[model samples]
Each structure stands twice: as C-alpha cells, then as structure tokens.
Target: MKKRSVVSASLLALCLLTLSSFSTADTLENIHQRKKILIAVDIGAPPYGMLDGKARQSGSDIETAQLLAKDLGVELEVVPVSGPNRVPFLLTKKADLVIASFSITDARKKVIDFSNPYGVIQVVVGGPVKQKIGAFTDLIGKTVAVTRGTTSDMELTLGVKEISGVNIVRYEDDATTNTAVSTGQQDYIAAAMSVIPAVKKANPSRDVETKFIMKTFPLGIGIRKNDPELRAYLDKWVQINLKNGKLNDIYKKYFGVSLPADMLN
Candidate 1:
C-alpha cells in the first residue's frame, strides 16, 4: 500500500510538471486567442503619433493603424513606444507590429521583417531660425542632435564620421532631440519634414527653420521575422488602403500635401 501510494504521488507530480511547462503561453498565440492586434506607436513623434490638445491620439500613423486594424478584423491596441525601444517592444511581444514611420534598412531587417515600402519620408536638417544649415557637408565640426536608432542617425553619423571633427548627440526620443536644437543646446537636429510642423507648434518661439537635405527613404511596417502571415496581411491591406484613397487622405490631413505618386504604389 505504501509503494502504491508513492507511485500515485510521483505520477501526479509528473502531470503537474507537464502542465506547467505547456501552460506558459506564446505571445502571438495569446494575441490570436484573444482576437486582438497590438500596434506600437511613438507618442512623442508628431504628425505620426502624438496627443492633440484634447489628449486624444491623432496622427498619420494613428489613422493608418486604425484602418489596418479594421481591415485585419482584429481589435486595435496602440502600444506607445519610444525611438530606442520600438524594436524591443515588438520582439518582447508588447506590440504585434510597428507602424511608426520605421525605415527599412538591412541592419533593422536582421532583427525584424518589414513589409514593402508604403511611402517615403523626406529627412531634413533643421537649425535655429537664425542659423539655417543647408548642407550635410556644412554639419562638420558642429554638434547635431538625432534620435537614436533612426535612419537619420545613421545618415548623419555616416556624414559626421567621414569628416574628422563633427559631433553627434543622440537622444532616445523626438521631443528631447527637438528640445536640444530649439533650445540652442545643439546646433542642428536631423528629422522628418512631415513632423516638423507639429514640433514647431510645440515650441512657438524657437525660431527654427528646416531645410531639405536628402531625398526621402522608404517607410514600412515592422513585424517579427517569424510573422510572415501578419506581414502579408499588412501588405495586402496597405494596397487596399491606397486604392481606396485612405492613405492619400491621411497624408494630406497631416502633411497638407498629397503623397507622391510612387508612395501610393
């Protein structure tokens, strides 16, 4: 009787261990199970994702996210993320995808997959209104602030490094980086033209003006490398959004201009 009782306890222990091992859930599976989709947003990046005076979210990416979720038939949940942590959010399962003006690059592609480029964003160099810097070559020997982990950072770093004396100051978010330049702490800030108007509004007396420096690059949604199905869904839905004029309307509403013809395709 003692041996039989001991055997039963051992079997029960094994069952419990098995259950515990299998019970820990996968994030994507949990999301699918719950019938919801999570999209990461950079609330600090205006004209992309930011709170208006009413505290409600409004931006190009916010509107795009809503449309994407509607077409996906999943509940949309926006997960706010900063510049440096956006990829971490997606990798850790906090966000199912990122629609936050993320650029497509080979370095980023190693960690996360991206859909075909939906649009292109022109990167510009801005300085205090009195000190307008027009060219990348001119940035040498100057201090420039750029958001960490962005293509702008990479582009500027490449330019700065090539010149022997330039200094690159990196920040984790757009607001801080903008503050650095507008407050006269940094000489210039590398940023997107689409979002500059909103930043200008935030700092009314900064006397800042921006100049177009480089042509824009492709922007696309980012997902984990394993999520091919999700990426395909996004690719198809973006096409639909373009055809229905939703993408163009969103761009015009935020940027005050229609998207380039190539951007729609």
Candidate 2:
C-alpha cells in the first residue's frame, strides 16, 4: 500500500512538471497562432504613451509596441494600464507584454522577469524656478505631488521618511499630477523626467524646472516569470533596435534627446 501511494505521488508530480513546461513554450507560440500580441501601455503618461488630437494612441511607448508587433508579424492589441496595474495585467494574462515605462527593480524581479532594458528615465524632483529645492533638505515643509505606485513615488517616499516636514501628495496618474502642479494645487512634483517637460510646456508661465534627480532606472518590458521563450525574444529585439537607432529615433521624436549613450552601448 505504501509503495503504491509513493508511485502515485511521483506520477502526479511528473504530470504537473510536464504541464508547466508546455505553458512556458506556449507563451511565444500563442501569439503566432492568434496573430496578435497584447501589450499593456499607460496611455496617460505623456511622451511615453498618450492620445493624439484624433484620440488615437500615440507616443514613444506606443510606437515601440507597434514596432514589436510589426516584427512579430502579428496584430497589435494595446491594453491600457496605469502605474499600479501594469504588473497585475501581465500576471493575470490580460497582457502578454507590459511596455508601460515599467522600471526594473529587485522587488518586482521576484514576481516577474524583465527583458533587456529598452529605455531609461530619471526620477526627478521639480518645482517652479523661484523656489529653492535642490535637495531633500530643501523639500522640508513643501508639498510634492507624485503619481501613485510609480518608481518616482517609491523613490520619493523612501527619500522623505527621515526628513521631517516634507509633504508628499499622491495622484492617480501623471496627467492629474501635471494638473495639480499647473493649477498650483501642489507646490512641487516627484515624477519622471518626461512629466516635467509636459508640465512645463502646458504651463509655460509656471517655469517648472527639475530641482534634483533622485535616481535613474532602466525601463524593461515586463513578462511573466518562467516564460523564458517570451523573455528571450524581447531581449534580442531590444538589443537589435537599440543598435540600429530605431529606438533612439523614437525617443528623440518625443523627449528631444537621443537615447543615453550608456544605454545604447
């Protein structure tokens, strides 16, 4: 009886392992079979993803997703995601890839794998030119707006804990944060470098300028952990595009600067 029970357990384990292997391989083949790749993008984040005057999706991230679909020879279906939900969308199978300006971090690596970085962004502290905010000490007693659940949010949160009198206001997205800054609802903003330009252009009279850079993070395409096939393809795709200047062109068109030399290398 004992021997029979042990043999049954071994067979069940083997069956589960086989199924896991099949699921991993399906990550890539499923796209080819369906002729569509579902990518999650944060359309509310300007310069990365946004809607144009025609209400059509347009931005660097949008173009990157389109390029990936073109190379895969598949139709592109964009799944709109926000900072808080990009990982959830990928893990829940709502998106096969997340190209939503997701910064690769150690905490996230434990849950999902990331492809080679396709872009980089600085977490910045920005305020009007007349205000003096060059460091955390400078932020004392000032309210700084930040998009919820973003790397900028995390960085700023960690940065202000030990520093007293710094007020951090959380918003749902960059658009809302931009509004808060433009309308004087908030004194400053903790955000990506991209958001600064958008806010500055929209409110030219505000003269918003970056005060200090918190840290730079590499942006990676988020994929489910254990999906080796998908990660492999994305890794190769990023390398080729970066080397060929296609990615830089997209960055320049939106951000007015070439991709960082360190990233291109």
Candidate 3:
C-alpha cells in the first residue's frame, strides 16, 4: 500500500510540472501551435494602418503584419487598436504584436519590449501654407491640434521646452484634427509627416504642409515584455527584410519614397 501511494504522488508531481511548462510556453511556440498570429494596428492612421473602401484592412502596417504572418507560416488576424489602446492590447495578451506606428521612447520602454526599428517617422508641425509656421517655437500662443494621447500631442504639450503659451487642441483622431485645421478652427496641427499628404489628398482645398520637424523617431514592432523568443524572431525578420529590400518596397508603396537612411542607423 505504501509503494502504491508513493507512485501516485510521483505521478501527480510530474503532471503538475508538465502543466506548468505548458502554461509558461513562449509566445512564438503558442503562435506556431495555434497557426494564427494576432497583430494590433491603428486602422485610423492611414498610409501606416487603416481600412480601405471595402472595409478590408489595408496600409503599410497591415502589409507589414501580413508579411510577418507569411514568414511565420501562420494566418494573420488584425486587431484594430487606437493609439491609447495599442499598448493595453499587448499587455492584456489580446494581440501577439503591435505594429501600429509604435515609436520607441524611453518612457514606453519601461513597460514593453520593442523589436529592432523597422521604419522612421517624423512628427512635424503642419497647417495651411499661409499659416507662416516655420518652427516649433512659431506656434507659441497659437492653437495647435493633435490626436489625443499620441506622441505628437505629447511633444506639443510637454516636449517642446523652448516654446511656451502654446494652446493645444486635442481631438479623438487624425481625421478630426485635420478637419479642425482645414476648416480654420485650429491655427495649426502637428502630426506624422505622412498625414500632411493624406489630409491634402482628402481635402484639396486645404493647403497644409509640414513646417518643421518636431521629433524624428524610429518605429518599432511592439512585443509583450519577457517574450524574448518572439522579440528575437521579429528583430531577425526586420533585419532580413531590410537587407532584401522588401521593407523599402513596402515603404515606397505607401510613402512614395524609399526608406530613409536615418531609420537604418
């Protein structure tokens, strides 16, 4: 009876250990086993990520996610996330990765792991050509619009030290912010440089142009913290694509130019 009891106890311990290992499996293993990878993208930010006329997800970020899925030999599932919620989606395990124009910053690095940079984006002050906005300091005491909770908003609100008395007008999304600028409701708006062309294309009457760069930052793929295997995979994928010119092709398709040199550095 004693021998039988010992065998039962050992078996139970083994079972528990096996379950623990499975529970702690890395994201890469889970993705491979599930045959699908969920990626978070901002469908509202066009030229980077957004929905097309057919409501199908289409844009640079969407294409990049598709390429990643292909490389992983898995199906792609895109989760539309806004600027504010992109990090939360990854933290909650709702998405395996976030490619939503996520820029690397010292503050954000504390909470998430970012893959090697895949692109560079410039945040610039944009408004009507006649607005006479030449630099960041020029917006002093003027109403500047930005998408609420975005890097652009943060820069205008807190990053620009030399400027003071700038009135920031926050909106829910880029379209709304652009509308305010286009309609003369806002003095000027700051956003991704890509947004200037998008806004001009959408509203031809609006003569918006980038006045000066507020900040230039490298955009990285967001991976959940402690997922080293997944992070390594993404970093390798970015390096490979960059060497093969596949990444530049994607950039040109959306931005009308090759990937900039500074992004690689």
Candidate 4:
C-alpha cells in the first residue's frame, strides 16, 4: 500500500511540474513567435513619419520602429496608413503596432492602448502671416481645416462646437489642408508643431506660418487592446532608448535639435 501511494504521489508531482514548465514555455513563445511587427505610418507626418520621394520609408518613426523591432527580435512591416484608416487597420489586426503619430485620448483609450508618449508636439492653427489667428477663442467663428480622422480634427471640431459658429473642414492629409489654407480656400489649418519646421521649409514662399493658438495634445504609439503584453514591451523599450540617449540622437539627426530633457527624464 505504501509503495503504491509513493508511486502515485510521484506521478502527480511530475505532471504538475510538466504543466508548469509548459505554461512558462508558452508565455515566452508568445513573445518570440511574434515573427514580424507590422507598423503603421502616415506618409505625410514629417520629422515623425513620412515616405521618401521614391516611396521608401524614412523618418523618425521609421528609425524608431526599426530599432524597436530589433530590440524585440522581429522584422518590421511598415504599412502606409493615412489619417482616416490608421486606427481601423490597428483594430482589425492588419497591423501589430502603429508607430504613426497617434495621440492618446480618453476616447481612443477606450478602443486601443497607448504606450507612454515617445514624443510630444503641440498642434496649432496656421494661416497666411497677415491674417494669423492668435488663439483658440479667435477661431470661434472661423472655418478650420484639419486632417481627417486625426485628433486635430476631433479636437478642433469639439472646440468649435463648444464655442459655436465655428466650421470644420476635414482633409485626408496635412498637405491638402496646408494647400487649402495657402490658397485661401480654408480659413485656417490645424497640424502638429513638429511639422511646422518641415512644412515651412517645404513652402518658404507660401507666406504660411503657424500661430501659437491652443494646443491639440501630445501623441503616442497605438497598439491593439488585446496586446497588453506587447504594449508593455514597447513602453519599456521607449524608456530604455530614451535613457540611453538613443532617442535623442535620432531626434537630433532628423530635427537638428536635441530632445527636451523632460522627454527623457
């Protein structure tokens, strides 16, 4: 009887140990089995994400995504997602991650998870230098053009509704909105300040310039809500890169200015 009991106990212990080991293996495999990370990029947002003239990927977000995939031991697939469909692509699992300039919002958080902000930029209303709007209140009765499906569009529309008499025009991308403002077809344009330098550089003769105005909000990388484990990995990875000065180096290389200490600290 004693011998039989010992044998049964040993068998139970072995099964439990095997099960435990399998669970651990499965968790690690989950992370590693993610062979390729699909990233979304807007071929429009410069200094953060954009496509080169030949349609090659090159930008801050591209470099950051590349380094992140390297750290995560995965290949990167950059998916071109414009403002309108970026979130839809992420929600549908067409992309594993979105390195696009996605802003973290309470409304957005309900659908997706955001990493700690990798970078921050203010959004402002821009117009021809002569008719510059000075503040959000000044925009109360004006027609504002914002990129469709972007936080800027949402925020400006909400702001307009709150203030009343404000009209919003949505475009598919920044370039179109900028062109609308430059041509006087739109009263004002809303976009990120990080884009200001590049847009001004691209159209020095347009007489277009940004007004301080009200801030839109900071931005962050977006991930599917089902992938908290992956989201946590990216959040920590961003901190690691920021701590080691890798993030700042990338910033300086593209923007020609060191990142603010607050971003790293």
RMSD of each: 5.7, 2.9, 5.6, 8.5
TM-scores for every candidate against the unseen true structure:
0.84, 0.91, 0.86, 0.80
In order of TM-score, best first, we have 2, 3, 1, 4
> For model 2, what is the alpha-carbon lDDT of residue 209?
90
True-vs-predicted CA distance for residue 205, candidate 4, Å: 2.5
lDDT of 4 at 259: 69
lDDT score for candidate 3 against the true structure = 0.85
- Angstrom error at residue 11, model 2: 12
Model 1 has an lDDT value of 0.79
Q: Show the colliding residue pairs in model 4.
A: none
**lDDT tens digits by residue: candidate 3, 1-265:** 9999999999999999988755632999999999999999988888898778898889999999999999999999999888878888998899999999888988889988899999888888887788777776777777788998888887777755666777887898776887777677875788999988887877788888898888988899998777878888899999999988888889999998888875544
Against the true structure, candidate 4 reaches a TM-score of 0.80
lDDT of each: 0.79, 0.90, 0.85, 0.75
Best by lDDT: 2
Distance from true location, Cα of 220 in model 1, Å: 0.6
Residue 218, candidate 3: Cα error in Å is 0.7
In candidate 2, which residue pairs get closer than 3 Å at backbone N, Cα or C atoms, i.e. clash? none
lDDT tens per residue, model 2, 1-265: 9999999999999999999855654678899999999999999999899999999999999999999999999999999988888888988899998999899999899988999999888889999889878888899888999989899999999898899999888988778888999877886999888888788777787789999999999999999988888888999999999999999899899888887898788
Clashes of 1: 1
Off by over 4 Å in 4: 1-31, 182-184
So what's the TM-score on candidate 1?
0.84
lDDT of 4: 0.75
